[model samples]
Target chain A: MIRMNKFIKLAIATCIIFSHSSNLYARDKLDIKGFLTIAGYHSSNDNLGFQPHLSSSDVGYKGDDEYLTLSKVGLQLNYQLSTQFELVGQIVAQKEVVVDNSDRIKIATLNYSPTSSLLFRIGRFAPRTYLLSDSRLIGYSNNEVIPNHDFYAQLPLSYVNGADLTYNFGLSDGVGTASIFTGRTEVNINATDGNTLNSKFKNLLGFNLEYQTNNWLYRFGYTQSQLANSWEQVDTAIQFLTLVSQDYPSPLVSWTEGKEFVEAYRVKDKWFRYKTLAVQYDNSIWRVRAEIGDLAADSSNIPKNKNAYVSFSRTFDQFTPFLTLSAIKTSSPRTFSKPDEGLVQFLSAQSNQNLAFGLQQVFQFAETSAYNQKSISLGVRYDFALRQDIKLQFERKHVEAIGSNLWVVKDFSKIKDEYVSLIMFSYDRVF
Target chain B: MNIRILIGLICFVFSSVASAEILVIVNKNNPISSMSKQEIIYIYTGRLMAFSNGEQAQPIDLYDGSQEKATFYKITTGKRLSQINSYWAKLSFTGRLKPPLALETQQAAVEYVVNNANAIAYIDEKYLTDDVKVVFRLDS
Candidate 1:
C-alpha cells in the first residue's frame, strides 16, 4: 500500500510538471477545462436519513438545515504529446455524506489512439458500469441533477487501476463500440459501529457493447469481480458475539470459532456480478431513456437486487421538464442462519437459553442489509444562460423492508413502509 | 387606412421572404456535392469525425451566442444552443472530443471552409459564393 501511494503521488507530480512545462513551451498542445455543480436539498421528514447514492453515507436531515452534500468542483487537464498520445488528469473536491470533505484525483490516464477507431487507456479510469459512468460526476453534462440513484447506487466501485481497450466500427449508418476492461479497486466502507471496512475487489473483468445512430443509442454491459472481506469488520462482529455469549454457563464458543463461522457464512471472499441494459432516444425536442440493472452476489449475506428506471423529457425553448420512475427490489430469500440444533439443544440442557436467542439476533441483523425501494421524480431544467443551467427537482420515495429495514438510519424505529419527499436545487456550469 | 394596412401586410411578407437561410458549405474542391440532414447532424455532433472517403473532417462553428449559430443548430439538429453545449460538455470532458472550432463571424467560417477542403461549415445563404459549395440548406 505504501508503494502504491508513492507511485500515485509520483504520477500526479509528473503530470502536473509536464502540464506546466507544456503550457509554457508547447502552449497549443495543452487544453484546460472544468465543471462545477452547486446543489442543496431539503427533505420533508427531518428524521429521514437520505443517502445520495449507495457509496455515500446517509446525510441526516434535522431541524431546518438543508444539506449541501451534493456540491462538487472539478478541473481537468489534457496534454497532447502527439497525434496518437495524450495525458489526461482530473481532480475533484466534494463534500461526502459521511466524510465531511474530500479532494482526490478522480482520473489520471495516458491515452493512445493510433486511429480514430481504436484507443487504449492506462492508469485509473472510471468503471464503465453504466451509460453515463464516465461523466456521472459532471452534472453539466446531464439533464438531471444526478443519474437515477436506484440504478446507479448499486455500483460499489467508482474507478479501477488498470487498462481498457475500445474499438469503434461503423455499421451501416450507425457506429458500434466494443470495450473490454480489467482492473482492481479497494473500497472503504464505514460500518455502523464506527469501524471502517476495507473491501478489496480483485480480478475485475468487464465488457460493454454499444450502438449509436443519429438519434438513438443502445448499450449492454456486464462485470464480474471477487471481493475479499475486511478482517476488521469480521473481528468486530466476532468480538461482539463473544461478549454476548460470555454469560452462557456451558462451553462458550471461542473467538476463533466464531470468526470461522462468520467468515463461512458472511465475510469470506465472494463473487459479485453486475449486468445492465439501457436505451435512449433523443431528437433535441423529446428525450426518452430506460435502463435496467441486476446486481448479485453468491453469498447469502449479500442481497441480490434488481433495479430499473424510465425517464421522459421534452424541451421547450430553454426549459426542459422531465419525469422519471425508478424501482429497486431485492429477491434474496429471507432465511436466517439457524443456530446449530445441537448447540441449541446443549444450551437448553444447560439452561443457557438466552445464548441461543443472542445467536439468532446476529443472523437477523445481517438480513436487514437488503433494500426495497421505489421512487418517482419530477424535475425542470432551465438554461438561464450560455453554458449554465439551473434545475429544480422533487422526488417522492417509498421504502419498505419486507424482512428488515435497510434504508433507515441508526434508528429504524422512526420510519418504516413510509413515503418521504426530497426537494433539490442545483446550479451547474461548464467553464 | 385600408391602403396603409395593405402596404404594411405586403412589407411583412417581403421581409419574411428575405430572411436569411442557413447553408452547409464545403470547399468546391471536395467531391461530395450534397449531404443528408442526418449526415450533417452526425458531423456537427462529433459522431462522425471523418468524411465518407475516410479523410479527416473538421467542422467549424460561429462564435458562441451568435443568433445565426443558434438558429443553424436549432434547425439542423433540433436542439437549442444550451442543450448542444451540455451535450458537448459530456463528450469533451470524457473522450476529449472538443467542440467545433468557433470563429468570430460567419464570414470567418466561410473563409475557413473555403481554404480547407477537409473543413465543413454553415453560414447564411447570402454568404454563398463561387469559392464554396452549398451541400445542404435550411430555410429560415
Candidate 2:
C-alpha cells in the first residue's frame, strides 16, 4: 500500500510538470518555464583567486565543502504585455549568495518590442556578456568553460540596474528565434574620487550593439565613467569631513575608482570609459568564439587595462572536446584589479575581460544541439547552474606592480589575474 | 537458362508484391496527390508541415505509453521509445516547439482524423477501407 501511494504521488507530480499551463492565442501575454539540474564533479586546478567562482576549479585556499552541490533550480516568467511590450523575470538559488535561501529573486524587468527586431528593457537583468548569457549556467549541455565563466560570474557591468534598448535584424524563420541589440544603460555609482563624479556611476553611458544570424552572432558595447579629479576630490573630502563632524554618516552608497577613504578622504577624479566586444560562430561540427574589452580613463589615459580570449569547440555525438588559447595584452583591472577604485571603479575593472587557458568537457545525457540548460551540463558547468539566477561569483585577485593601486594592497597569496569557473546540470520535459 | 531458376525468380516477384499490400486512408475530402513513404514519415515526425497540395496537414498520434503508441514509433519514425522521448524533451526544453496532441486510442484517433479534412492517421494495411485514399504504405 505504501509503495503504491508513493508511486501515485510521483505520477501526479510528473503529470503536473508535463501539463503545466501557459499562455496561448495572445500576441502579448505571459509564458513561464523552469529548469532543474544536479550533478557531481571534481577537478585538479583549484581556481582559487585565479578563476571565476562558478566552476569546480574555484575551490579557494582553505575551506571544507561538498564534492557535489545542487547546481541550480529556478523559474523564469516571460510576459508579453503588448505586441511591442514584454516583461521577463528569472530567479535562481545559487550556492554562494543564496546558499541558505531557496527563494531568490534573481531578475525582474520589462521589455518593449517595437518590431520583430527591436527591444527595450529596464530593471535589474543579465548583462548579456560572455557566451552563455541566454543559456545561463545550465550545466548538462555546454562546454565546461562556458558555465564556469557565466555562473561564477564576476562582478561585471554586463547588466546595468536601469534601462536598455536593443535592436535585432534577421529572418525570424530559419534559425528559430534569435535577436541582437544596440542599446545604452544608465547607472549610478560612487567614484574613486571623493566627488560623486556626476552621481552616475563615474558618469559613463553604456553603448552596445549586437547581431545574430544563421550561424554567427556578435555584440560590442562601450561605457564612459569619469574618474576623480585630484583637486575636486580634495574639496569633496573637506565637505565630507564637515558632514561627519555635523553628525551625518556618508550618504553616498557607491564611490570612485582606485581611491580609498583616508582620514581626510581625498580622491582623484578622471573619466574612465570601458568598451566590451565579443563574437561567436558555429557550424555543424566546429564552433569558435572571441571577446575583447577595455577600460580607459579617457581615450588617452587607459590606465586600467583589459583583455580577451578565443576558443574552439568540437562536438562528437554525446561528448564534446574543447581547446581554448586565450591571451590578455594588458592586465585585467577588474579580475586582477582592486576593490575600491570606489564602487564604480571596482565594478568597471572586474568581470569584463581577464585571460587564462583551461580545458574541460561536458556530458549531456541527451543530445544538446540547440541550447544549454541546468540539466544538460556536468562538472564545473553543473555547479554554475546551481546558482543560475542569483549568484555572486567573485575572487580577490591581487596584482603586484609598481605605481599601481592593486599593488598597494599587497595580499600576495591570492593575487594574479582572477580565474573564475562554473558548471550546471539538469533534465527536463516540456509539452 | 535452367527452367527451375526461372520459376524461382517468378515466385520471388509474386511474393514481393503480395507483401506490398495497398491500404486505404480517409480524410474528409482533401485533394492531395499520392504520398511516398518518406513524405508520410516527414508528416508524422512534424518535419514537413504541408501536404502535397500545399495545404497545412495535421497528423495525429496515439497517446504515448500504450501498445499502439509503441508500434507506431517502431514503424513510423523507426525510433525506440527512449529516442522519441528524448527528441521531444530536447525541443520542449528549449522552448522552440511541442509534440502533437495525443489521443487515447488508435480507433478514436483514426475516427477523428478521417473526419477532419486536414488530419492524418495511420493503420495496418489489413484494415483497408473504401472511405479514404492510399497515400502511403509501410515497407517493414
lDDT of 1 by residue, A1-431 (tens): 01223333443444344432211122336777777777667766644566566455435454333434566766788888897898988877665432222226767889998776677999887888778888888887887887786777656465778889988777888978899989987765544333345677888899999999878999999998888654554555555454433334446442335434454445546788999999999988999999998988876556788889999999998899999999888886545334445555565566545655556666765666666889999999998877778899999888774522323354556545667788888878776
Per-residue C-alpha lDDT of model 2 across residues B27-105, encoded as one tens digit per residue? 8487874776655655554444457665666676655555555556656555544445434433333222334545666
TM-score of chain B of each: 0.88, 0.69
Q: What TM-score does model 2 achieve against the real structure?
A: 0.46
In model 1, the number of clashes is 0
Residue pairs with backbone overlap in model 1: none
Off by over 4 Å in 1: A1-28, A64-66, A97-103, A190-196, A228-231, A235-268, A334-337, A341-358, A402-408, A413-415, B1-19, B27-31, B114-117, B125-133
What is the per-residue lDDT of model 2 for residues A1-431, given as tens digits with 9 covering 90 to 100?
A: 01223323443464365443321112215456554443322222232222233222223222222222334444666666664566676665444322123225545667765543345666655544434453444433344423333222322333335555654332342222233332333222222111122222334345556665444657776655544344443454344323222221344233232122222233344555556777788653466877766654432113345555566666444334555444323342221121222332332344242111000000010111111111112221111111121112211122222211211112424333432233323332222
Q: Which candidate ranks first by TM-score, i.e. highest?
A: 1
User: Pick by DockQ: which candidate is best?
Assistant: 1
Superposed on all Cα atoms, the candidates' RMSDs to the truth, in angstroms, are 7.3, 14.3
TM-scores, one per candidate: 0.83, 0.46
TM-score of chain A of each: 0.82, 0.52
Q: What lDDT score belongs to each candidate, Candidate 1 first?
A: 0.73, 0.42
